[model samples]
Target: MKTVVITGGAGFLGSHLCDLFIKKGHRVICLDNFLTGKKSNVAALERDRHFVLVEQDVSRPFRVAGSVHLILHFASPASPVDYYRYPLETMRVGSMGTHHALELARAKKAVFLMASTSEIYGDPLVHPQTEEYWGNVNPIGPRSVYDETKRFSEALTMAYRRAYLLDTKIVRIFNTYGPRMRIDDGRAIPNFIAQALKNKPLTIYGNGMQTRSFCYVSDLVEGIYRLSRSRYHDPVNLGNPREMTLKELIVFIRTMTNSKSKIVYKPLPKDDPKQRQPDISRARVLLKWQPRVAVEEGLPTTIAWFRDRI
Candidate 1:
């Protein structure tokens, strides 16, 4: 069986990755600092012989047993409220944390898959951002700390691949939602859902005209697993092609929960994308991956999950 190490293995995406690796008959070493990770996410895996959790900060160098077959780096504050509130910590983890993961990958001679975000697209001018787009980003803006750090993380990975001949891959993830999402966050899906469930006014920023593509977490994880097993070394976009506006999304959530909440408008946050979607042609062509779960199918499950929690 292959041995795999996943950073941030207790967070929403990381916890899911740990489960996937362990289920596929791989020894999973989950490294997380619990900065934003929840213990409940990994509680189910504690009984599994193949699953091990280690609370380690990736800012420092650490060692793991056995030769790791793959390293999934998903350790960073992903939400806007997170990055904005803890900008330095976010930057450190993205920069220093990624450096440590790359070192671990090199030590184990493993394939390292860096979880880059579509945030690198930064208010994308392109309709559906492809892997080739350079992106229109503000270097000194509020989102720059996160955006530039990811850009650096990608650059560092590419350099390591070229210089050290290490096997590395990158997936620029777009909007993903499902169980275990942070209810306090400002992501439209969770934000709207949480507000609606609590019988609070649903807040819409900037006329709610901004659009985003939503990918179910299951589909995203499937794509990540496929990319990790493949030989492609460059970045690939993994996201749902289905797009919708904020207003339409709020209405959908209101209908989904059968809540009596009215829509309230607020000024758009700085650096909010006008339009964002992924061009997954590369993922489709290379990894043979396309999102299977529709937003309709994914949303109900999420709504139920949140309903149970709050």
Candidate 2:
């Protein structure tokens, strides 16, 4: 079995990956500083023989003993709330953290995978953003901390691949949601679900016309796994192509939750993308992957998790 190391392994997506790899009989070392990641997320695997949880910040230089066949760099404050609250930390992880991860991969001659985001496309000028379209990002904006850092991470990964010939891959993740999502993470799915469950008004920012494509966590994870095994080194977009406006999502959640939550309006956040969608033609052709879980099917599962937690 291969030995895999996942940075940020105690976080939402990272914890799930740890479970997946361990289930497949691979030894997994999960590294996290817990700035945003919760120990409870990986609590179930504490006794597993193949799982090793390491509390270390990737931004700082760290080393591992023995052979490491794979390294997945997922260390970063992913949510808007988290990054906005810790902008400098976000920048450091995206840069120094990524650097350390790359060095580890190079040393072990392992496959390096970076978990990038669709935010790199930043208020995209192109509709249904494809992997080829360069993004339109405002460097001085509030959201740049997350967006630009991801962009830099991708660039740095590519540079390592070219200079050191280190096997590297980057997957640009779109809006993804599922169980273990913190209620106050400040993403749309959890925010709407929490507000609706609490019988509070669902807040819609800026007329709620801004569009986003949501991919269930399982679907996204499958796609990332496929990309990791494939030879294609260029960035791949992994997300459901179904697009919807914020207003529509709120209505759907209210109806699904059977709540009396009224809609409220707020000024839109600066640099928030007006339209967000992924053109996953490449993923479909290359990875032989497409999102199987529709929002209708996925919502209930997510709601049940939140219901139990809340």
Candidate 3:
């Protein structure tokens, strides 16, 4: 079995990757500092003999005991609230933490997969963002900490592939929601769900006309797994192509929860993309993958999980 090291393995997406790898009969070494990740996310795996949890700040250099077959660098604060709260830390993880992960991959001769986000296509001038899009990010804007760092990480990953001949893969993830997402994730799905469950006002920014494409977490991880095993060295967009507006999302959640929550309007955050969607044509051709779960099929399960937690 391959020994896979996952940085930020206790966070929302990372924890799910941990579960996927272990289920596929691989040894998993999970490293996290619990800054934005919670230990409870992976608590269920603590007793497994093949699962190893290491409390580590990956922005600092670290070493693993054995040979690693793959390293997935997913150690960064993803949400606006978390990044705005810890901007410098977010930058460090994207830069220094990514450097350390790449160094470890070089040492072990392991395939490296960098988890990137669609935010790289900030305020995207392109309607359905493709990997070819250079993006329209405001470098000095409030969201630069997350966007630019990810852009830097992508550049660094490509550099390693060119210079060191490292087998590196990058996946540009779009909006994903599922179980284990923090209720206060500061993203649209969880925020609306949490508010609906509590009978609170569902807040919508920017007249709720801006659009986003949501991919269920299970479908996203499956595509990621496929990419990890493939020979593709460039960034592949992994998200559902189905697009919806924020107002529609709010109404759906409210109806699903059978809540009396009213809609509240708020000013859109600066530099927030007016439209967000991915052109997954590359993923379809290269990975033979496309998202299977629809919002209609996935949201109920997510809402049910939140109901139990609340």
Candidate 4:
């Protein structure tokens, strides 16, 4: 069996990936510092003999004990709220953390996969963001900490691939929601679901016209796995292509939870993308992957998960 090392393996996305790799009978070494990640997300895997948890900050220089067949660098504060609060830390993880992860991959001759985000396409000028779009991000904005760091990480990953001939891949993840998301992570999905469940006002920023495409965690994880095994060295967008407005999502959540919460309007955060959607043509042709979960199906599942937590 292969031995895989996943940085940030205790966070929402990382934990799910750890489970995926372990289920396939591979030995998994999970690394995290708990800066934004929680140990509970990965608590279930602690009992497994093949699963190993290493409390580490990827931004710092560190080492894994043995040979690693794959290195998935997913260590970073993901949400806007988290990144804004920990700007310097976020930048360090993306830049230095990615450097260390690449170094490890190089030493082990392992396939390195970097988890990027669609936020790189900030305030996207294009309707449906394709892999070719260079993106329209403000370098000094509040959101730049997360956006530019990911951009830097992608460039760094590509540099290693070109200079050292490392086996490397990058996947640009879009909005993903699932069971383990923190209640206060401050993403719209969790915010909306929590408010609906508690019968609190569902807040909407900027008239709620801003759009986003949601992909279930399972589908995103599947796409990541496929891209890791593929020969493609460039970045691939992995997210559901179906788009919906924020207001529409709130309405759906309210109805699903059977809540009486009223809609409340608030100013949109600066640099929030007016429109966001992924053009997955490359993923389909290269990885033979497309998201199978529809919002209609995915939303209810998420609501149910949050219901229990709330």
Candidate 5:
């Protein structure tokens, strides 16, 4: 069986990935500092002999024992609230943490995968962002901590692939929501869901006309798994192409939860993307993948999970 090392393995996306690898009959070594990641996310896996959870800050150099077939660098503060609170830590993980992860992959001769985000296409000038888009990001904005660091990580990954001939792949993930997302994640999906569940006002920034494409976490992880197994060395967009607005999202959530949460308008956050969508043509042709779960199919499951937690 293949041995996989996943940094940030206790976080939302990382924990899901850890479960996927284990279910596929692989040995998984999960490393996380729990800075923003909670131990409870992976608590269920503690009993499995094949799953190893290590408390580690990957921004600092670390070593792993034995052979590793794949290294998935997913360690970083993902949400705006988390990054704004821990900017230095976020930058360190994307820079130094990524460097360490790449070095480990090089030493182990393992295929490396960097978990990138569509935020690299900040306030995207392109309607449906493709890998070719250079993006329109503010280098010194509040969101720069998360956006630029990911851009840097992608560059570093490509450098390793070019200079050291490392087998590396990058996936530019779009908006993804599913179980295990923190209640105060500070993202649209989690924020709206939490508010609606509590019968509180659902706040919308700006006019709520800003658009985003949501991909179910299961579909996103499935695409990621396919990319990890492939030989592609460039960034591929992996998200649903279907687009929706924040207002519409709130309406749907309110209906699903049968709540009376009123819509409240707020000023838009600076540098927030006006439109967000993915051009997944590359993923379709290369990975032979497309999101199977529609918003209708995915949202109910997510809402139900939140209901239980609340």
Candidate 6:
């Protein structure tokens, strides 16, 4: 069995990757600093023979005794609240941390897979952002701190692939949601869920017309897995292509949670994308992957996880 090391493995997506690797009969090593991640996410897997959890930051060079066949570099502050709260940390993880992971991958002679985001295509002028489209990103904006870092990360990944002949896979993930997402994380879906659960008004920005395509975490994880195992070296977009307005999403969440919360409009945040939908034609053709979990089916599953009012 191959040994897989997943940095930031105690997080929402990282923990899920850990579970997937362990379930596949591989020796899994999970590393995290616990800045935004929780221990409970990986607590259940602590006792498993195939699972090993390491509480450490990836910005610093890390090592393991045995050879790791694969490394999933997922360390970063992904959410708005997180980036706003820890901008410097986000920059460090995306820049230095990604470099450190690359170094480790070289040491272990493993395939390096990065969990990049669709935010690289900031406030996209392109209708459906594709892997080939050069993004329209602002360097001075607040979102630049995260967006630019990811862009640099991708650049470096490509450089490593050519310079070092490293096997690298980069997947540009879209807005993914599911259970284990912290209620206070301050993303749209979780924010709506938390507000509805508290019987409070759901917040919508700029008249709630802005649109984003949400991919279920399970579907995203599956796509990432497929890309990592495939020969696709360029970044692949893995997300649901179904677009929905913020207002429509809030309404759907209300129905799913059976909440009586009214909608409240707020000033839009800095550099919030007006439209975002991934063009997954590449993923479909190369990886044979398409998101199957529609928003309708995903909402109830997520609601059930948070139904007890945490």
Number of colliding residue pairs in each model: 0, 0, 0, 0, 0, 0
Instruction: Report every candidate's CA lDDT.
Output: 0.92, 0.94, 0.95, 0.94, 0.95, 0.91
Q: Candidate 6 lDDT, tens digit per residue, 260-301? A: 999988899878889999999999999999999999999898
Model 4, global lDDT: 0.94
Q: Write the per-residue lDDT of candidate 1 for residues 1-310, one digit (tens) a residue.
A: 9988999999999999998888888999999998877889999999999999999999778888778889999999889988898899889999999999999999889999999999998988887898899999999999998999999999999999999999999999999999998888668899999999988999999998889999999999989999999999999999999999999999999999999999999898888889998999999999889999998899999999999989
Which lDDT tens digits does candidate 2 get at residues 1-310? 9999999999999998988888888999999999999999999999998899999999999999999999999989999999999999999999999999999999999999999999999989999899999899999799999999899999999999999999999999999999998999999999999999999999998999899999999998889888889999999999989999999999999999999999999999898889999999999999999999999999999999999988
lDDT of 4 by residue, 187-236 (tens): 99999999999999999999998898999999999999999899999899
Question: Which run of 10 residues does model 6 get worst, by summed lDDT?
Answer: 301-310
Looking at model 3, residue 278 earns an lDDT score of: 94
Error of 3 at 162 (Å): 0.7
Using Cα atoms with residue i matched to residue i, what is each candidate's TM-score against the true structure? 0.99, 0.99, 0.99, 0.99, 0.99, 0.98
Put down candidate 3 lDDT per residue, 1-310, tens digits, no spaces.
Answer: 9999999999999999999999999999999999999999999999899999999999998999979999999999999999999999999999999999999999999999999999999999888999999999999988999999999999999999999999999999999999999999798999999999999999998899999999999999999999999999989999999999999888889989999999999998898899999999999999999999999889999999999999
Range of the 10 consecutive residues with the lowest summed lDDT in candidate 2 = 219-228
| lDDT for 192 (candidate 1) | 94
Better of 5 and 6 by TM-score: 5
lDDT of model 5, residue 103: 100
What TM-score would you give candidate 1 relative to the actual structure?
Answer: 0.99
Stretches of candidate 5 above 4 Å error? none
Report the alpha-carbon TM-score of model 2 versus the true structure: 0.99
Model 2 residue runs over 4 Å out of place are none
Model 4, which residues run further than 4 Å from truth? none
